[model samples]
Target chain A: MNAPATERFVVPIGPQHPALKEPGHFEFTVEGETVVDATVRLGYAHRGIEKGAEGRNWTQTLYLIERICGICSHIHSTAYAVGVEQLAEVEVPARAQAIREIICELERVHSHLLWLGVAAHDAGFDTLFMYTWRDRETVMDILETMSGNRVHYSANVLGGVKFDLTDESAVAILKGVEFLEERTHHYRKVVSEDAFFLQRTRGVGTMTHAEALALGVVGPTARASGVARDVRLDAPYVAYADFPARIQLLTAGDLEARFLARLDELLDSFRLIRVLVAGLPAGELTAKRMPRKLKPGEVISRVEAPRGELFYYIRSTGGEQPDRVKVRTPTLCNMGSVITQTIGHNLADVPMILVGIDPCFSCNDRAVTVRRAGDDNGRAWAWADLRRYGIDYYRRIRN
Target chain B: MDTITTQSPPRWRTMLDRLRNWSLANSPWLVHYNSGSCNGCDIEILATLTPRYDLERLGVKLQGSPRHADVLVCTGPVTRQSADRLRRIYDQMPEPKFVVAVGACSISGGAFRGCYNILGGVDEVIPVDVYVPGCAPRPEAIIHGVAVLLKKLQPDRAEEIDRLLVEAGAVVGEEEGIDEPNAELLGAR
Candidate 1:
C-alpha cells in the first residue's frame, strides 16, 4: 500500500488584515480550504511593559498595569492591587471592595459590548456592530461618571479607589442599567435569530468540552464548551468572595454558544453591579493604614476579566519599586485552542474563529526588538519556513 | 454656435460646500495601535468611542485596517521590536494622515522613560499631529484634542500651521530645553 501524498499551502492572516484590529502575524498551512495547521508569531506590539514596571513604585505600577489591555484595564489594576495588598498585608475597606466589584462588573459590560460589536463586524454584520457599540456608550458613560475616564478609569489605587461615587452617580448607574437591559435583550435576539449571524457563526469553530479542558481554555471560551470554570466563582477574591457568582454554562461549543455565553455573562454582570450598588457599604474608600513602602515579599493574584482568568505575579524587595511583575492574560491560554479549533475550517470562517477567543495580542507580547541582520528582509516567510527552521535547529542540537 | 452662459455656484454656496467637505474629510476613521504600555490610554480611548462620549456621532469610526484609517491612535511608548512593525503599519495607511499620541508615555515616555528597549513615545517613529497629555488623558480631553486637530485641517487654518508646528515641537527655530534624551536620539535617527 502506498501512503497518500500531503500538499501544503500558506495563508497569512495579518499584521494589518481586515479581521484583526491589533498587529500580529498568523500563518496557516492549508490543503484546499481546510487548515492543516496554524502558527501564531507575535512580538509586533511589544513595548517592554514588564521591564518598565521594575523601577516604578507600587502606586505607579497600579497605573502601569491598568494599561495592559484597554478592555481589561480594571481587572489588570485589580489583580495588581490585590497582589500588592497581599504582599503588604494591607486590609482594604469593605466599601472599597464593593466598589471595586462594581467597577469590575461595569468593565465586563463594556468589554463584552465591545466584543459583541467586533464579532458582528468580523462577520460583515455592520448594522449589529453599530447597534452594539451604540449601546456600549451607556456603560462607558456610567463608568466615566463614576471614574473620571472611560477606558483606563484610574479608579483603582494602591489601597483603594481614588474617587467615590456620589448618590447621583448611583442614580445614573440605575438609569444605565434600565437602558442596558433593553439593549442586551435586543442583542440576545439578534445573536439567536438573525439569519445571517446564525449562518456565519453557527457550527463554525466548534470546540468540544474535552478539547477545551485539555487545551487549558479559560473564560467564556471554556464555559461555552461546558467546562464550568470561572475564577470569580472558583477562587473568589476581592468582593467576589462575599457576592456569589453564578457561572453561566452552555453545552454547545460552537460560535453561537460562545456568543450566547458572553451575552449571558454581560447580563449577569449587570445584576452583580446592581447588587453591589444597592448594598453600598458605608466606610473609608481606602485603607487608612496603607504603608508608603512595600515590604519584601512575592504574591500572585487572579481575577476574572470579561475574557477569562487574569493572573498577576509581583515581587517587592522592601523598596518603593517592585523587583518584578509578570502578567499571564486569558488570551495566552485562549490562543492555544485557536490553532486546534481552526483546523478543518474554511478560510472565510478564519476571522470569526480568531475573534471567538477575543485574543489580546498586546497583553501577551510586550518585548522590545533588537533587530538581527537576517530579520530585516521584505520577503514573506510562511509557516513551512518556520517549521523547517525549527527542524533544522533541532537536528543541529541532536548532532 | 451659441455661447453658453452657465456658471459655477455662487461664491458663498461654494464656500459652504467646501466647508462641509472639509469637515467630512477631517472626520477621520481611527485605528488604535497598542505597541505596549500598561493599558491606561487604551481604556480611555475606548471610552471616547462609548456612548457617553460617542466618537462615532462625531463622525469618528474605529476601523480595523490601517488602509481604511485616516488617523492612527497610538497608545503606549513604542518598544524596540515593535518599531519596524509600527513603521510598516504607518506606511500602509493612505496619505493625508494624522497620528494622535494618547497618554503621557506615548507623548513623552511618561514614567517608562530610559527603559532598555522602550523607544519612548510613538512620535519618535511617527509624525504626531496632536498630543493628549495625561498619565492617561480623560476621554473628554481626548475628544477635545482630536477636535482641535480636525479644526486645524481646514484650508482657512493654513495661517495657523506655524503655531500648530510650534505646539507640536516641530518648529526648527526653537531651541527650548529638550525634555527627554530619547527625543534627541529619535531626532538623530
Candidate 2:
C-alpha cells in the first residue's frame, strides 16, 4: 500500500451520481482504499432564490421561500412568516401557532423516516428502506389530508396559518400517530439492535463533541455528538414555548448515533403532537388586520428544520416588496463536518458519511458573486446590467 | 452486420423483433437527474419506487447510469451549472431513449421560472417525450407519466391492445373464462 509521496489520487462523485439523490460535487483524495483528503463544491442546485425573493412582495416571497427545500418546506415558510409577522407587528393566534407546531412535528416524522430509508438504501439494506418508506406513507397521508398537498404543504400564512385543524383531521392525526408510534418503536429496536445494519453505521463517521462544536454543526447532527443545539429548545418559536420538545441527545457521534438521535426525535415528535392536539388552543386562526406593506425594519427568523436550524434574514424598505431576503439553511452548517470527518475513512464510506448530515443540496446552494472595489473601475451595475451579465455568462457556457 | 432493405424481414426475424419490442416496452429502465429542483419532485419520484406506489410492479427499474437507462426522468428547472451536465447525460444515454420531465419546474420552470440561475426547463436542453406538470406531481401522476411513456414506446401496438381489451370485454359479457385471457394479456406487457 506504500505509494510515492508525490502521487495523489482523487475521486469525484456527483453533480450526477447514483449515490447522490440531489446534485452536488465532491472530490476525495484517496491513498489505496483510505481517504487522504476531501473537498466539496456546491452551487450545482443554486437557482438564485434569494435574489428572486427581493423582487417579489412579502406574500409572494413566502411562497417562493417555501420551495427552497421541499422536505422542510413548512419550516422555511414558517420562518419567513414569523419574521414578517414580527416586522408587521401582528400577533398570530394561539390556535394557528399550535397547528403550525403539529404540522411541523408531522413533517419531522415524514422527513426522518424518509432519511432513514435513504440512509438504509445507501448502506445496501433495501429491506429496511422498503419498510421505513412504507411506514412513511402514513404521515404523508396525514399531511395530504390536512394541507391538500403532499410535499409543499402551503400551511403557513403571513400573519398565521392557512388552514385550521378540524376535529375529524385531529382524530385522524391521533390515530396515525398511534400507528406510527408503534412502528417507530420497532424501527428504534432495529436501528439500535440489528447487528448486520450496525456494521455500516456503528463506529463510522464518528465526530467528537469538540469537533462538532468546532465545525459548528446544528440540529440533530450536533445533538448526536452530545451538543445541546436545537433552536426549538434554545429559542422556542411558534408554539414550542407552549408545547416544548424534549431534546434528543446521544453521546456517540457516529452514524449510528445520528440514526438513533433522529429516531428518538421522531418519538418525541409523536409525544409533542399528542400533547398539542390534546391541549389544542382555541382562538382565531389569523390576526384581524395585516397591512399590505410592512414597516421599514430588519428581522431574523430562526426555526429548527428537520435537518437543523433554518435562518432567514428579511429587510423591508417600507414597500410591498422586501429590500433583501437571505436564507441560511441547515445543510450549509452541517456540510463542513462531512469533509472533515470523511478523511482517513474508507472511500466506500463516503456516501454514508455524506448522508450522515442529511445534506440537501437545494437547501444550501445559494450562490452569490463577489466583486472587489478595485476591479472593473468600481462600476456599479444596474438591474439590466446584472440581467445581461447573467445571459452572457450562460451564453458563454453554452458556446 | 445486416444492410438496410426496403423489403420486410423473414417470419422468424419479425417474431424476434416483436419480442424485443415487448420486452423493451415492459421494462423501461429510468435514470433520474435533478437539474435544480427544490427536492420535492426528486423525493416524490423516490417515493414512487418505494412500497406504497411500487412502480417496480410495472417492470420499471431505476438504473444508476444513463447508458443503461431507456428513460430519463428529470426533475427541477435546469440551472446554469447543471445545464451542460444535463445535456451530457442526455447525450450519454443509448439511442431510442425517452425523457420524462417530472415536475412543473422541469416543464416550464414553474415557481422558479424567472430565477437568474435557472435555464427554463428540461426541454430547454433536451427533447422531452412526456411532461408531468405539478409544483411537485403526486406519485400517482408520476406513475401515469411513466405509463404514458410506456404507451409511447409501443405506439403501433397500443391500438391493437385496446381492440383486444374491447374484444375481451365483449367475450366476458357473453360467458365466463374471459378473466384468464385478460390477465395473461395484462401480465404479458
In candidate 2, stretches whose alpha carbon ends up further than 4 angstroms from where it belongs are: A1-7, A368-399, B1-20, B155-189
- Among incorrect, acceptable, medium and high, the docking class of model 1 is acceptable
Q: What tens digits encode model 1's per-residue C-alpha lDDT throughout A1-399?
A: 332336667888776665776767788887777788788777656665687788777788787777777678888999999999889998999889888999888888888988898889889998787688778878877988888776678888878888887998999999999899888988999999989889998999999998998999999999999999999989998889887678999989999999999999988988888888888889999997778788888998999988899888899889989998988888888988888888889878888999999888877775322467787654544647644765685467434
Using Cα atoms, each model's DockQ against the true complex is 0.31, 0.73
Superposed model 1: Cα runs more than 4 Å off: A1-8, A366-399, B1-33, B37-73, B92-98, B134-153, B157-189
Interface RMSD of 2: 0.6
> For each model in turn, which proportion of the native inter-chain contacts is also found?
0.53, 0.88
Q: Candidate 2's residue-wise lDDT over A1-399, tens digit each? A: 678755768898988899999999888898878899987878889998988998788899999999998999999999999999999999999999999999999999999999999999899889999999999999999999899999999999888888999888988899999999999999999989999889989999999999999999998999999999999988999999999999999999999999999999999999999999999989999999889998999999999999999998999989999999989888999999999999989998999999999999999998555688677755656758865986796567434
Q: What C-alpha lDDT do the candidate models reach, one value each?
A: 0.78, 0.88
Interface RMSD in Å per candidate, to 1 decimal? 3.2, 0.6
Q: How well is each residue in B1-86 modelled by candidate 2, as lDDT tens digits?
A: 02112258887776765665677787889999999999999999999898888888777999799999888999999998899999
Model 1, DockQ value?
0.31
Query: A220 in model 1: Cα distance from truth in Å?
Result: 0.9
